[model samples]
Target chain A: MTMAQMDRLLFGDNQFFGINHMSEEKARAQAMRFQKTDAIMEVLDVAYAEGIRTFMCTTHDRITEVADRVRADPVRYADFRFYPCMPYAHKYANAVTDHGMVGALRHFMPSDGVLSTALTGGRALATKEVDGIAKVLIDMEMKMFHGLQTPVIFVQNVFTDLLLGMGFTRALRIFHDHVVTKYGVEPAFITMNMPMLLEALEKEGIERPIICANINKIGFRMSGGFDAYLDALRSGRVRAVAMSVYASGAIPPDEAIHWISELPGVESIVFGASSAGNIRGTKALVDKYMGAPA
Target chain B: MDHKVRIGVVGLGKMGLSHFAMVNAHPQVETIACDGAGFMVDVLGRNLENTIYRDYDTMLDAERLDAVVIATPSRLHAPMTTAALERGLHVFCEKPFCLDWADSERLATLAADKARVAQVGYHYRYVGAFREMKRILDTGALGRITHVLAEAYGPVVLRPKRSTWRSQKSEGGGCLYDYAAHPVNLLNWFFGTPAQASGSVLTPIFSDGIDDQVTATLGWDEGPTAQLSVNWSDESHRKMTTRITMIGTNGRIFADRQECQVYLRAPDPALPGFEAGWTVKYTTELTEDPWFYLRGEEYSAQLADFSGAVAEGQGKAVENDFASAAQTDRTMAMMIENAETGQPVGAPPVTARPTPARKRGWFAWKA
Candidate 1:
């Protein structure tokens, strides 16, 4: 997909692509292949010309330059704001130490480690460690987001599999045991995978809350594919789907549009791009599937 | 068919199961025998039934395999691999090849003498993206590199019972032995050898007297410095993401293992950055395929590569050759010695501690 097309689609959907730093070689390769940075800015400009809005990067060292570049050129990329991923500890410290509030920040530290090792070998850290990490992370958030030096810090929970695998059995149980029981910080919203997550939250006594269904689950576990995702959203298994449309790389415009057509009850999908190609493709996909925000 | 090779697996622990799975599913490989602790073999019975042996010697004697993949505990890798090489079986063994540098070097000499296929399971070397980074560094994109900051933070693999072999210092159950190999190997890979290596490690959480966390610095021969922070008592389960920032004369590059992105910013007047100009120009999601993300493919690929190398009749050279693992083992030995002796490992003892740094603002919060 052209970077412009990808940005357009993501802009239409209110999303930002956050790229992680692994190593120098892989980073260099991604930069060359994805046509990121200056090349991607040209795409974003074109996307803006084509009427796309709200471009954002995941506030990271690998993409901070572009996020800063866009933010500086307010006339052309005024709406571009970098959205840093959260659990707060993982991304915020790095952002504060490195980026210094180029854009917004979001935290999503799964109580369990990423990738679900608790399932493989019932070997998760104790509840105290979880609380400690979360508190340190939350303090970081309060310093950055609550102080209003930056924009809002959205705490996201993309997948609850790790928590469930760690034996919470539900998201609400995690909330109660982690949030309510300990920190007493009632969640403003909760995002999760399916009804199982929601039911778990309900069982834990979480009241009617804003729910974000992860449509991106289809991309990773696409065996049952997109229809299954839509079915879950429509069937009340998922209250409101927060669709993450990009993985591996941004989907081409055609595939993205086809993907949107086959779904139902998608409240919003967070689309991110690495290049103008992804932006333009995403815009076309959104225009085709989500239509103009009337 | 890509010249399938027959293989036998030793030590069917987690790593063993992973290797067996890799060999069985790999397009050009066959795992002949899977041997391990009695309970592990019994549980994995029949599924791994082509050939399974309880005794190590019997398995080595009976299995006329092209190669052997050893995933036994750290203590077993050396002896097991040495025996396999002696028997003319190619070997692909797990890291730290041996606890002692002397033993590892001995194995290296044996490997050279045997002249067979041997390869260490430094599986990180086979990571597609990491390989790409090695290529870029080889091309000198970052210029004359000076300093590198690396971290390997995670939870203690040895559990509360403290009965496992991993919890004993005598058996290589320390943070440096278990976790430091990654950065140490990378350092060796990147900047030849260090002129001097010093480390300070602690075992705050575990009662096993093995270090749970370590901070080590290596001064390279080429005037470059590398710092490593490792912990076995991490707050989370495990995260092996290594963050490498190369300080070069012309420009600087920072890479994060989790995001799989590289940020490069050269000296530019237009850009508002310090003398060490920092900006992230490139970003991308690493392939999160379950097979790849779980490191299943890389493990499989290592087997295939090792088996192929063995099939080429270079068994002794293809697996656990020990030369590479020895550098890390030596560095780790230094770390352990320093942690215990209150002096740099392998260095003359000093009565006084070095000048301590001023307590920083973060100290209070951490406290």
Candidate 2:
């Protein structure tokens, strides 16, 4: 069996969803700018043309349209892959409760594996609410990327940090096991505190697990401090994927990318930029600093 | 003080649960949970490996807690906080410290007398952009701020909804205490307690006997004037959007949760970050990453500060301390009185109060 190769540079979905950690003005403006799916696809196309094969994104509602377009036109995006992240958990449970299991499965599940997924729901429905909710979220969130290449699934920061804080790290293993067994894909964790998570994952018997976190020169959102991250990366115990490499535009492209390229174990960099010029410029920086993508 | 601060958390509403999660997770803290709601306590107890209590006083008595975090409804803050302080426990209470100004003043003095770490959850002070605003203002980059605009709008009550404690005048103090108090507290942090607050209006769009919108004017003796416009009913925004814009003689400074925009007519060598024209600095640039992040960095940051203050023991002044919150509470009281009497309250003479020696162009807002 062979594992899918992780792309060195991945385009991110934050720009499409108006998630600017820096500027609300820019977030709101870009949100309005990318209201239509075409605008998002156009940027994705630019990223794809510039040699970014992977799209790391949250399972937002609009992603269905993008998936449909990608699935519809396989020739244009021949090597396209998705790294789908989970969104709001409460919203998922609400959907299941409001629409009932079967009704929500209709709205949420893609046609290909609906039968088996819904059948598993019977056993899930018998479990406690918390366990049931997690199942519903994973199943529904993955439903959008039907018949697409999803090499990696991510547990969002909110869930990852909460579990990390609560010391319920056993759940991380459950997530990894479920994603691997069910989807036949690797599960990665996105967290603010990469050092803590690396320890947590290692304790859970997951070795060299891909963990993405805020890694930048200013150390903007890289929790557990820069020294800890440097130690973790230098030791090569975890498969590191650096996100927020630009620190949300705080650091310039050449400066941020060059700094990240020097890190020991970072295997990927994920970024979000709306404009084609930005996408091209950042891709050029990544290639220049870290060599061309595999 | 105990090496690991033993803490008890009371009231497990939304904010309470989150605070409990962070508190229970702290490395330097051993925390127990309490809530009046039996179901909440039971649920938390079943999942989390911690002692849970149904009564606040019972938890305080049973546990040798050095501190307590009060995240109850707004009405219960004053009593809960007072009880915790009386126990010689450091208290970190949720915002709108008290619905009434007198309670705020009383509690402020009580916390001072008791020598306990008293902090209110005005988490905005932890936000990076706002902190940048403070840093610039401290540098005297925006010289002699004259006029200001403070606004907060959110899509909270878009249509008529059933009233909960949140929508009630008595329990939550409606929009004035519950919603507008956020920006108002930020105003207090920027300027000293306003000498006068006037032209206050509290209007309801979707709730009865409570305000969903608030508008008012605040003034300081030094010269800076400010307007407060907040509406929770506005649907244009996705969430609560608080912004402050200051117009000064030297330049203008504007800040929100995400970014700070600074303008200087003639840039000084001392202020390297800002140019002669508009320079924008973002939250990403200003903030350090938290050891743990929940909701946003600010939420975890506030709890971490409270924990650190508790560990440091008495005389460790918190950033958003009870005294600082009392200033905001008093300002709200002035606005409420002005609204009732159709006249300005606490209006100082339209002239100079004897300027303090420290009141140079540097730290002008300190006065």
Candidate 3:
């Protein structure tokens, strides 16, 4: 299998979207401050300068603008990478943005009457059709990341768990296959329930997939409970990418990074920092805990 | 109560399946599902361990359910909820409780009369930022909120091609019921039922008969008034973006899903956690993670609250009861009735005034 080197520390885009789990005031301030694309790029450039290449981002509209700039200045961002998380709605479901059940259907429907088609046959999407639908949406979402080294791509937690719940793990298999075959990179899944997702993915014969979830000392948002996560990490069931490591700012950076660094199988830690100092500080912490990224 | 709470989820659509998963995983709950669609029933039946039913009536007849979660379209909500409630089963119906105001009011009364745990899925109420906002507002921190703006925007209808149940006015009631009700319900939650609604407008950006953009004003004679703006055709937003901005005598408050932004003249001890200048509260601190989280903390929290309410009996008050949803339904009905966009008051009969001859005009100018 061909996969890019997973960094000890990766940059994320939650700060750009004004998502703060810990401090709403700080999140609002960052959101207002990063209203302009240049502001986001400035912070991203800081991470890039500090040797943080991978940017884990959702496919929000503003990020498309950011992608345009990144695409234009190739030489400047030669080693720049994107670890895109998609369906934009997945990250924002906490808000009343889901537009209801039919609204979600519209997001992935290839043509109209997905309902009609589903009614006609119990096997709504055959292998080819599933491939077609999955590939079309994936390609469309991946358009902004074109020519950039998107070494890793993620299926957002909402879609991941939805598919998992409906016993449609096949869709995830399809997502994994498409992202791997077409993109030539790792296809990852982000979910709240780590153990359940691991079991579901393994059931689909997707062995040791790259899974990202909330991994903090407090077990904040770790759905299967923190002990289950520790066991999964201990067993090396999957290649873990630690996110929300600070539990949305609840955990101190030192304590947060220390816990993740001591975990057995966390391949990467994706974090968002506003300042050069913050980025460098996190990088230094990662270096201190896990040693510098080779 | 010792025995597991038996729940049957009706309508095997996106939300239905999500609710099933969340409820199915609950340690104290046993979830079954029913759908009219053969494909969905078959797909789920073959995959999941729980029983799947093809017909709603058949499922109700066959299974001994303690409650039913109705996630059907807007029109079906009334009938499905009525059926479930008639069975003396607690009902958790999805939003836009009933498209018909009278029906919604009737159902609310019936649910109360029956003393059943009747709830509506206005999940935003479970969001921590909004919950914290409510806490602060109740404390009179943003004293005497004068005007408020409630907005919900999304990229649902960029360039409409085929019509789904969502695009049909009779079915989903377009953006008003499918999208706008969420923020409108929040408005009702923050302030009581509006005294009046007016100047409502529904613009069909792409769809023919249904609204793609909805705008209106809701006024409370005794309290703050709110301006509602909702559009599903906006591509700028990846998904729906609902925000509430309140301006008051003391300070101002603005919040969405992520964070609550507040500005106060001075720190009020009632909301003593913050200082004077400006304070923001994020959902992370505001929200407590539920036992099982599927989509969002709010989704899981909403379901958790429902099951908890069901388990606790009628003594436990439901935060989002049928009566609150009835108020939202009434507000929605008022907006629909007030929406007089069909007759755009065209500039009253442009009559051409007689013009004087060029020579006479020139002579008059010279004089």
DockQ of each: 0.05, 0.36, 0.28
lDDT of 3 by residue, B102-186 (tens): 9988988888888888899999999888998888899997767888999999877777546557768888668899899999999
lDDT of 1 by residue, B21-116 (tens): 556544456666556444335434522334677777887677666677788888888888888888876677788778888988888788777876
Candidate 2 lDDT over B134-210, as tens digits, reads: 88887876777888999999877776765467777788657888778989998899887998888999888878788
DockQ, computed on Cα atoms, for candidate 1 = 0.05
| CA RMSD (A), model 3 | 10.2
> What does candidate 3's lDDT look like per residue over A40-72, in tens digits?
999998888888888899888788998999999
- Summarize candidate 1's per-residue lDDT along A1-294 as a digit string, tens digits: 111122223332122222333333444454455445666666556766756554422333434465566556667655543333334234443343232221112123343554223223434344544444445444443432221112222334422333321223343343334443433333423233344445545655654433443455336423223454466556754334354454334555466556655565454455544466765666666768777542
- Candidate achieving higher DockQ, 1 or 3: 3
Question: lDDT-based ranking, best first?
Answer: 2, 3, 1
Worst 10 residues of 3 chain B by lDDT: B343-352
Best by TM-score: 2
After superposition, the stretches of candidate 2 with alpha carbons farther than 4 Å from their true spots are: A89-129, A288-294, B38-43, B138-141, B266-276, B352-367
List candidate 1 segments past 4 Å from native.
Answer: A1-245, A252-294, B1-3, B46-49, B157-161, B236-238, B259-297, B312-321, B342-367
TM-score of each: 0.54, 0.87, 0.80
TM-score for candidate 1, residues paired by index: 0.54
CAPRI tier of model 2: acceptable
Write down the lDDT of every candidate, Cα atoms only: 0.53, 0.82, 0.81
* Per-candidate iRMSD: 14.1, 5.0, 4.8
